[model samples]
Target: MSERVTPSAEAARALRDIERRRGQARAADQESRWVGVVFGVAIFAELAAPDFFGDGVRSWIGLAVAVLGCVYVVMLRTPRGGALLGRPTRLRKDELSPRFVWLARLAILAVMLIGPFGLRFLPQAPFPYTRTVVGAVLGATLIIFGRTLQRALTSLALRRDDKDGLGGATYGSR
Candidate 1:
């Protein structure tokens, strides 16, 4: 005779595993969103300095913002123990491709570095006008990344739910 397994016991084990995975995915998603927002804000603030601060003050302010952004990025690059940001638990490898991550990082850095000189494209462009435009672009980029992260997390959550036989109710859905 084959050994018998209790249905309740099996269900409980599955439920527990599912909960554990869900928590990991949620934490990963939160970290991704926070990183994107912080970087975006830093870029915007750095570029906006010219609008509010005089040349001498704006230079220092922009340098401060850039340094902070660099520090945050460095923290993310460090190992789990050294990370200033919390590590993700259950995020799938393919959910965030390394190539894409690098590309996004490079793009953000380029924007931050080049944004201050955006006014030069239009000779004699007003400081306020250039700052406003650059700030808007940086803000939009952040929003785009935020949406991308949300979608990635949603898809990951959906995949996990399906794998766990949790049916069609997605984690973010009602």
Candidate 2:
């Protein structure tokens, strides 16, 4: 025999579950700040290698760095890696605006395609260390802005949750 659950009780339970999951996602986001630093350093090394090493050595270094990055990524998918590195979680569709999400994706894609080539074409005199400069700027951006961006996205999701009738919850309060 099972007890009946009222609609209000079920709704409350569902809201509680949503809050729990959102809390976990926020924790995971905080834990992933270090990941940005790791990839930032890797990107800087890959780009800066050519300035300090010969073509052959640069290729080898780049290969090694790429392999390491790939391995780290693969490891992050494992249980132990998730414990160590924090597994990333996706926001529910209702928690994000599709238009904003698509715009962000497109912007990232454009930067990925144009950034390196665009840097190469800059005047040599003003930007002698073009690759290094770009790498450092990108690396620094990742390391420094990663947490900030995460907070912004988290806030956006929370706002959506509030709009959906869940009371607004602050990251600190969670």
Candidate 3:
């Protein structure tokens, strides 16, 4: 009798693949905000529009952010994304701080959803109907996140350098 590969293993493999994709997606997500900034700027010159149109833009941004957030969380939870983001070869174990990462991502996800809605209806904030708030929030988050990710990656490189005694290790003391 031959032992076949179990369905769970296949599922696990699939999840791993998804996780890898999510990491790529996260890096890409940083880009998404930049794109949104450009788009927002392009539309900023507009002096007039229907109120309902603003609502549509908010809804769209919220949905997009939620979708991306869902993807990110799914991958992070999976073995593959975790492996890539936390792999010793890619990032130092200390640098991948699950606590900070989860908090930052959750903040992004919340902002992505809430910010857009605020743009639509938050009366106290300027540009409440401009739909630019989402882009601004996203861009700011990306700026911070990009740095954090880079630092995380650097921590790993630093560890490798330390191991090699390269006399050039300068990270991961924070």
User: What does candidate 2's lDDT look like per residue over 1-174, in tens digits?
Assistant: 999999999999998897886666666645466788987898888777777674566778778887987878776556566556655443445556666777779989999989778868975636556678888998899899977877776665443426744332322221
Please give the clash total of every predicted structure, in order: 0, 0, 1
- Candidate 1 residues lying further than 4 Å off, grouped into runs, are 1-23, 32-41, 77-84, 88-120, 126-128, 136-174
Clashing pairs in 1: none
Candidate 2 worst ten-residue window by lDDT: 165-174
Q: Count residue pairs with overlapping backbones in model 2.
A: 0
lDDT of 3 by residue, 80-114 (tens): 66444342122334434466667768989998999
lDDT of model 3, residue 118: 68
Q: Which should have the higher TM-score, number 1 or number 3?
A: 1
Choose the strongest candidate by lDDT.
2
- Per-model CA lDDT versus the true structure: 0.60, 0.69, 0.47
CA deviation > 4 Å runs, candidate 3: 1-53, 83-134, 137-141, 149-174
Model 3: how far residue 78 lies from native, Å:
2.0
Clashing pairs in 3: 19-81
Model 1, range 118-173, lDDT digits (tens) per residue?
A: 74686775654687587869776885677576656455334332542433232331
TM-score of each: 0.48, 0.61, 0.32
- Ranking the candidates on TM-score from highest down gives 2, 1, 3
